[model samples]
Target: MENTEFRVELVRLVDESYPVVVGRDLEGSVAEFLADKHPDRRAAVITDSNVASLAAEGLLSSFGSRPADLVVFPAGEASKTREVKERVEDELIARGFGRDTVIVALGGGVVTDLAGFVAATFTRGVPYVSLTTTLLGAADAAIGGKTAVDTPAATNLIGAFHQPAAVFIDLDRWLTLSDRQIREGLGETVKHACIADAVFFEALEDAFVERGLSPAEFVRDDALAELTARRNCEIKRDFVTSDVHEGNRRMGLNLGHTIGRALETAAGYTLNHGECVAIGLALQSRLGERLGYCSPSDVARIEALLRAIGLPTKIPEEVPVDRIMEAMAHDKKGKAGAIRFVFQDGVGRLVVHDGGSYARPVAAEDVHAFLQSQV
Candidate 1:
């Protein structure tokens, strides 16, 4: 990819603020952003082994003359845990990092969440920037102030909302991803389109068919992919700006996350976050239609797009529905023993339903029935 530039606006969450800068070659720009925000002359970078080699090198090179440290974690969601957090914190302390130090997260959502949490809690919070390398991170996880580490019982159970100083998105990294990783990111992209922009969703569907593109090709076209990324980020920004703490409107972003999170835990963190989210989106759309929130045609469209993009539109055969529901009971969104779900009223609109009134929240019976319909 030649030199390319694109702009993504800043979203100021209540009591926090961060800029989401989307462009090519943003690895170098991260240093400039950090210098302006925290010129304290010391910083630490937390990244997974896989991404550290591919992406973190550019970021480290960018911080010329500044004192910086690198901390590596295992490369997967399983690393987002108490053990990893303790290790990262220990490294920071051993390095003699003070409150003046900044943390640069240089990987996917898991790295950003775990590292950002460390930055947020260490010495009552220090500055950090999000150098998102994955598409899912760039579109959703990286921009939102929400950071977390997972517990044995639930995913992202222990966490905080620590907004980053800035988010630098380098589209060039998309070219290096395997087809599977690219498909994983498309799941979230589809979610954004379903909940916020019908036009964007339709455009992607048309493009998928027209070019005979795989998920990898679809997301690597910098111009087209960046448009989708910006749209998803904007959807999240609008909600976060209105309900910064996720007290209300912002909860809509959890549309498929309720089931998605449950699926992750049920799979023992084996399923990719975006892949679980893809299945959750399909399930939720079916539920929406059953509840009169959407038309059958809309649900079909969603399923078709996900399938075309190489995402799983149904729950894995190995995981039973009962196990998934049991996991849902432990979701962070559940309250008073009832799981709360962000369902849709239609494309681009959402409704949050309390689970207490229904036996298997999200009307698991209804969801199961819908699944049968798909089969």
Candidate 2:
């Protein structure tokens, strides 16, 4: 059978343009692409424990020659740390791998982020490619070159901006994901639509809200998968092309990520990243309503779509509101010593603050009050 593919060219803020390829059963195509692109560079596969078996073989095959090594770490958000990063670097060094190695992140978001950071500092910088395995990675994590590890303080407080030479989001790899995982990815999907493409937002409403289908019911729906993969990369491309380092307009991509990261970090990652963002998407839309940037119905529609897709639209009781606030204080998005957030202007567009930044600073006390009310 012939393979169908969706390609988005990402012209990053630095260096040459990179291609993001989205397709199902893409191992063969990926091999040819990577071999052509980096023929002389040695290859290294950096992944996690759970994804090592699933990712190594195909990725090693992409190099045309045997890879230098497979660097696997523990497979969860917890492993997204400086320590794990050090270990990965140490292994690569001990194996004689160096600056000429093109790191292949062959797992989910964690691998992409951690390995990209490793690439950023390894011999001052080396190139990497993303073989993103999970739907969440395909939706939000794999693109944009925003790679980082978490500290006790905040999510992504310690990281770097290092673009990959290319990205491959293989839909076939995501078939192993559970239903909740699919919903988590959809949360980001809905977020991308909410911020840039009103038509995409309406398409999501039609599929998940009006039709009322579980994300799993359409798990094998290739057309929907292709649409989602392409749109995710394309929407992100708009931001990275302009602000690769996230200096200005790129903050628009954080519409649901502000409160989402704080809560997830505070919750000690007990919550899935996508689910927390779903809650944040709902909360921020409501905050937008409070500021008159959007209508109440707009907020309701956002929450309804999230709920219809089986994502959590409310904060869990166990995660303290105060802790979430504390984490937000440490967020990388802070400006003027105030916590700024990216809020939506109705369903499909983001609000640009009067201060010239795409995000605005709402009083911390106000955010606390609103969060307390949600409990």
Which regions of candidate 1 fall more than 4 Å away from where they truly are? 1-15, 267-270, 332-339, 351-375
lDDT of 2 by residue, 62-112 (tens): 555545578889999899999999999999999998778888888889889
Clash pairs (backbone) in predicted model 2: none
Deviating ranges (above 4 Å) for candidate 2: 1-14, 61-68, 152-154, 332-338
| Superposition TM-score, candidate 2 onto the true structure | 0.88
User: Against the true structure, whose TM-score is highest?
Assistant: 2
- Residue range with the least summed lDDT across 10 consecutive positions in model 2: 59-68
Candidate 1 residue lDDT tens string, 213-274: 87667766777878877887888888788877667677777778887888877776678888
- Clash counts for the predictions, in order: 0, 0
Give the local distance difference test score of model 1.
0.80
Q: TM-score, each model?
A: 0.87, 0.88
